[model samples]
Target: MTPLRQRMLEDMSIRNLATNTQMSYVQQVAAYAKYFRRPPQELGPEDIRTYQLYLLETRKLAPSSIGLATGALRFLYKVTLKQPWAVEEIPMPKRPFKLPVILSREEVMHFLEAVSSLKHRTLLTAIYAAGLRVSEATHLKITDIDSQRMMLRVDQGKGQKDRYVMLSPRLLDTLRLYWKAARPTLWLFPGDLPDQPITRDAVGQACQKAHRASGIAKPITPHSLRHAFATHLLEAGTNVRTIQLLLGHRSLATTSRYLKVASSTVCATTSPFDLLPKVEEPPPLTPTPPAHF
Candidate 1:
């Protein structure tokens, strides 16, 4: 590897960034350098601006993607090179607040049932039942499932933190049946190799197949199951803070976004008008006539 790349990797390692994040940041910086056909270290602030514009107009990248690229470059210049850098020079694109697409309970049931493979079905059931990210689901170890306690241990989930999620009886039953059929030794959902857990892409592909077969056209994904889990819990009157803990969200604000999408919660909530007592306004005209006189 190049000295620049090595130094950047070390910097990211020192900061304890996730492997995925480190790779993305490095890749983005490499792309930025390649765009100009010149060494990134040789580039200036104006070059960064032009590249940002290129990503925006030429490449038609989404605002979130542009923001990620800008962040990567900012880290490269500011941290790795120790240059006089200002992140403000490259303004972040305004990201639209899109509510997550959630599945109804019936839709979720149909989608899960449509998954043909017994193993994939069980894996997805665990994800939806426990509100696990695909990464968390794939990485789950056999030992992580606490049958007696009725919770699943998620190790090194997003932000490299560990947490426990409630294990539903239905999910447990499915997992038990799957284990009996497949005989996975270590990983709860082992991949083709058996030694390794299933890949994230594999889970995504399985979800797509199930979605096509189920005919619930709400644009579902593995993460959408997680969204459905949170939304369903909120709709069922679970506390927002409890959902926050289950999802391992660092901010309550992130968990609270489900309120916008939870149909039951929105429908059940009393509006300000509904809460107010009725009052008549009949004395305004008499006061107005006296003021005019």
Candidate 2:
């Protein structure tokens, strides 16, 4: 690896950024450098602006992706290289606020059932059962399952914090059946290489395959199950705060977004109009005849 790359990696490591985040930042920076066929250090503010336009108009990257690339470049210049012009030069893209697509309970069941691979199905099931992020689900260890307490331990999740989520009895039974067949020693869902756990991409591919087989119209990514988990719980009248903790969201507001998508919550809510006193409708009036031209 180049010294610049090594230094940037070490900087991210020092800041305790998530592994996926670090990888993404590195890749974005590398792409930025490759675009100009020159070292990133040789580039400046104007180059960054041009490249942002290139990403938008030419590469057709989404705003969120451009924002991610911008974040990486900002970190590279501001944190790693300590460039004074970083803040003024590099601006983050504005990402639109759009609600996530959530599957209904039946849709989730159909999707999971359509997954042909036992391991993939089991993994996806556990993810939805516990409202786990794909990375958290993939990194689960055999010991993380606490059958006695009926909780699944998540270590170093999104924010490098550990938390416990509910473990369903049905999911536990499913996992046991999977264990009996696969016989994994360390990771619950081990990849082809024994030491490492399954990759997020693998889970994504499985989700896509099942989505195609199930024929559900809405897009189904691994995170869609997580969305379904939260929305389903909210619909079932689980407290938003409790769901917040279960989903490991830092803010209650993040958890509350599910309220917009929860059919039960929306339908069961009493609108202000319902509280008004009853009033009779006025009698309809006949249309006036037109005047002579």
Highest TM-score scorer: 1
10 residues in a row with least lDDT, candidate 2: 260-269
lDDT of 2 by residue, 1-293 (tens): 99999999999999999988999999999999999999999999999999999999999999999999999999999999999999888988888888999888899999999999999999999999999999999999999999999999999999999999999999999999999999999999999899999998899898889999999999889999999999999988899999999999999999999998899867887898999999899889989999998
For candidate 1, write residues 205-237 as lDDT tens digits. Answer: 999999999988799999999999999999988
Identify the candidate with maximal lDDT: 2
Candidate 1 similarity to native, TM-score: 0.90
lDDT of 1 at 170: 84
Locate the minimum summed-lDDT window of 10 residues in model 1: 284-293
What clash pairs does model 2 have?
A: none
Model 2 error, position 260 (Å):
1.2
Error of 1 at 73 (Å): 0.6
Clashing pairs counted in every model: 0, 0
